[model samples]
Target: MTKTPPREALTLAAAMNARRLSKVFVADQLGVTPAAVSQWASGHRPVPPEKAVKLADVVGTEPHLISARYAELQTNESGNVVPIRQAADGADERRNDLVIARLENDVDSLRYALGALVTVMTVHRPAEGAAVAKAIRKHVPVKFVKQGYVAELLGVLDKAGHE
Candidate 1:
């Protein structure tokens, strides 16, 4: 009589069997070298932290069992040793903050241009205002108009001499 082997030993092998999931295919899905997959499956090396979650999902197993060091790769971009959890959250926040700042500046510039356009259209050519606005609205959507960018839309009228 023989005991059943643990699931980890058979995981990648099973995936391979299930749908002809080849080593190259699995490596592509997991963003790893085929050699890395072979080493992990053979128990020569523990699965790396980044690949653990995806590999666990692929094999339908809990992540911690796949790799004991599931949370921390303990290496930084500059090669300094640090807990990934600590740096990861801060780096994500900084990226979000930078993106938000850039978007805000872009919207501000749009608003200033819109204000200038309104001054040109209504003050300069008040009579043909409706026609000029309609022509510009053909290009700019209603959302921008509601967001107070109607003036930029109407700025097109200035170029076309619609006024």
Candidate 2:
């Protein structure tokens, strides 16, 4: 039995993900079983050079990147995989910042919409009430409305006292 080339194996996995190609599809295309594809992906069986070229074409990626990554994986087989902590941390921070910005924008927009709805509701009756109710009901889920029932009751009392 010949040892499978590491680069070929890694390239196969990367190509699978990058192309969004399934093992079943690849197997069918390659005239092989899904288990065989799985083995190749797991680095147990290296893809042959001819198959590697075909995979690169199918995956729409430069064959070199896949080959290089595979080589890197081969060199790092000392049982200690370097953790991509910094990249993960950076990704997490960026994700949090985006979530915060989105939340801030949503809050601002909701407040403005709520204020406008209140003003419209005050000026217009029956028709406007129905429209505003529809708008609110559209945006606010039944579960959320039910959860806020108590707060809503308090808000009604607060408004009554102020008026």
Candidate 3:
């Protein structure tokens, strides 16, 4: 019989820790029993591809990492072995900071766009339809506006203006 790879097991363990997800919760999310989750974690059984991806989602880890760890665990039966390589804590912190910065920038841009929409709709009520549309286009991408979120925002603005 083939052994579970170390990387695969470590990845699964790391994902659980990173996500703060319980083994029982992950199993429930995957529609499996907690015993199955434990088995996978213990490297006694291999996780199927589809279930592995679902497990990763529950664990908030990439599916690729879980797959790699599963392979590593197959090679080492000790179960205590580390299968995945983890970055230094400082490096992890830096990556999280970068993620937060990007999220903040996105929020700021969205807020600016919403403000522009409100400004154009309220103060410039007599403006031509094309001008209002142009202002919206300038603030938000055409593709992004297609999902009706822009319309919803405009509806709110209109209601707020009335009250």
Q: Report the lDDT of model 2 for residue 24.
A: 92
Across 1-163, the per-residue lDDT of candidate 3 in tens digits comes to 9765556667787778777878888888899999988877767766765575577678877555666534333222343322223434454455456557768999889978977766666666634434555566679887775657676665555455555
lDDT of each: 0.62, 0.57, 0.64
Best-first order by TM-score:
3, 1, 2
Ranking by lDDT: 3, 1, 2
The parts of candidate 3 lying over 4 Å away from their true place are 1-5, 68-163
What is candidate 2's local distance difference test score? 0.57
TM-score of 3: 0.38
Native-referenced Cα lDDT, model 3: 0.64
lDDT (10s digit) by residue, model 1, range 1-163: 9645444546645655666666777788898899988877666677776777687676655555556455333333454434333456576465446557768999899878767766676767765766767766677677875554465555555544543
The runs of at least 3 residues in candidate 2 whose Cα sits more than 4 Å from the true structure, single-residue gaps closed, are 1-91, 130-140, 147-163
Q: What stretches of model 1 exceed 4 Å from their correct place?
A: 1-89, 127-129, 143-163
Error of model 2, residue 129, in angstroms: 0.3
lDDT of candidate 2 at residue 10, scale 0 to 100: 72
Q: What is the RMSD, in Å, between candidate 3 and the native fold over all Cα?
A: 13.8
Give the lDDT of residue 102 in candidate 3. 69
Model 1 Cα RMSD, Å?
14.6
